[model samples]
Target: MKRLALILTLLSAPAVAQDAGLAARDAAEALEAASILLDTAEDSRDRVAALTDTVRAFEDGLAAMRDGLRDAAIRETELTRKLAAQDAEVAQLLGALSALGSRAEPQTLLHPQGPLGTARSGMLVAAVTPGLAAKAAALRSDLEEVTALRELQQSAAKTLEDGLAGVQRARTDLSQAIADRTDLPKRFTEDPIRTQILISATETLNGFASGLSQITENEVAEVMPPIEDRKGILQLPVRGVIIRQAGQADAAGVTRPGIVMATRPSALVTTPTAATIRYNGPLLDYGLVSILEPQGDLLFVLAGLDAVFGEIGDVLPAGSPVGLMGGDGGDIVSLTSEGGGAGRSETLYIEVREGGTPVDPLTWFTTE
Candidate 1:
């Protein structure tokens, strides 16, 4: 009877173990499916955000163009007034010269032959010649003023035209971005209240920087690829030459731990890698600035933009357009040591930080 009981227990144990194993496998499969769904949702949310940024960028571009046009018009009006004044002066001088020319013959003015000729020549030398010389000088000055005014007007007009073209390009790009993401599902929406707070907060950069350090981000279980793996492989956010490198001292004698790039007017700025926008607005003396977080404990600071696209918390993919550099409208002047000046339309400042410590960005980008 004891032997029979032992055999029955062994058979029951095998059946129970098999049932547990099957249940564990089913649970694992369910968990995997849920993870996949979560990933898909995040992807769709990012797409919608990117599309929204594109639309906002287009709107901003149009507004900028309008502002530029208005400025151009004002400048042109001023130039026109100056030119008109110069034209009147030139006309007056020409009229005086014409009257003098009509009264005297060239031969009599140049060489007198008799007593009447000698008297006329004395009169010409005493009064007419001096007046002519003065009028000619005035005419030359007026002509120079007119020429300068014309050049200024032409430059203003060209700037306005370029701004219009930029707006149209922005519109087309916005449309394309919208179409590309139309099929995506949205899992996240922007919080207007939070965004307003960020925009309206008139705090110093140090204050904002401190606040940023305290904000916690939602954790995703998936591991992010390390930035270290992409050393010397990443492209620059903008196409330009690096004018200032990290740890260089500026004119102010303060050491700067970022890179400064010289770019063309209205050049587009993009993300070098996938990142979440930490902040986007004016910060201190940097003008329009953008702060991005690409991975844990890493942040990128981009500054000196005229217009920015994404809001805080917006996720952008690698190489996604974020904003454009402010154009000089052919009016910017940078003084040099030679007592001359050059046009520097835009300057982009880039700073990288790892755990709040500044790091050299040249090690990460393929600047060539």
Candidate 2:
């Protein structure tokens, strides 16, 4: 009886040990599952944050574009009123000229005199004719200005329409990008304190450029494709005619090395190559400028934009939308050669630099 009791106790002990082993295995699996869930939650949170930032950026860009459109509309209305006034003035001038022509014969008859008087009258006519010619020339110049202004107004309207469409497209793309949640590798995170300091400290282009140069000194170099091999093969950032090429003197006699393109108002600007944006904002006389670096020692500067998109340090693929030209106001006097036609035109200045030396962009882009 004692032996049977001892055997029963051993059997119960083995059963109890087996149960403990099973419980330990279950706890280990549960802990691993919990850890996995925690990791997944953290990943999801990071993704959500990235998506939010992207959406916010898109919203800001859309707002800027809309603001530009509104400003253009206001400019258009003002130009229309000025054009109407100019038309009335031109008509009044024409009427006055007609009256003068009609009275010429009578005035000559009423002044009955001899050969000496006739010679005096001829001299008077010569002086008066020159004055009339000057007035006519002035009228023609005014008419040309009116025509050009009207063309700009029309182009602004077209640009507004195109901008609306572009905004909608960008919205859709932003939504899609968020949904996809693509995990793009980060190049470098911006130091908020440093960026703020740079923003507040730099007032001029040279100052801002100096700050950027300093910032880049500490950045890890990124591998990029060779840009030197693509000379004359790159597409123009904006579609237009090269009205002014590098080294050409502008009306101001400022012979800065760059290409000035006469583009349709509100024309969309695009990236010419895969590049990282270094600077994007108003600088000096260049209305909104964007600086892109495609590879080592190569920088592309695009100026005269109305609105710019993408933040500094953003890596963009080739042909990505960069910004839009605000086609509202123009230096009509400077644009006489190009804007004298029926179409409205805006100017864009592009410059390429290698190792701080300006290079002709015509050699890199397909201007035709």
**Count of backbone clashes, every candidate in sequence:** 0, 0
lDDT of 1 by residue, 1-368 (tens): 22223223223333322232232223223323333333343345554344334433433333333333333334435545766777876677688677667466655455447778777777866676687778686556544444443343343334334434444454345445534544422223445565456545746444455456334344334233567788678888875567788988888977777888876566667888888777777877889999877776788889998878765666677776677788733332222211111233478999887777778888777876
- Among residues 3 or more apart in sequence or in different chains, the pairs in candidate 2 whose N, CA or C atoms overlap within 3 Å are none
lDDT of 2: 0.58
lDDT of 2 by residue, 175-280 (tens): 4443454443334445656756786787755465556655443355785688888988899887567778799999989887788887655566778888888778
Q: What lDDT does the true structure give each of the candidates? A: 0.57, 0.58
lDDT of 1: 0.57
Model 1: weakest 10-residue lDDT segment is 332-341
**Candidate 1 clash figure, as a count:** 0
- Give the least accurate 10-residue stretch of model 2, judged by summed lDDT: 329-338
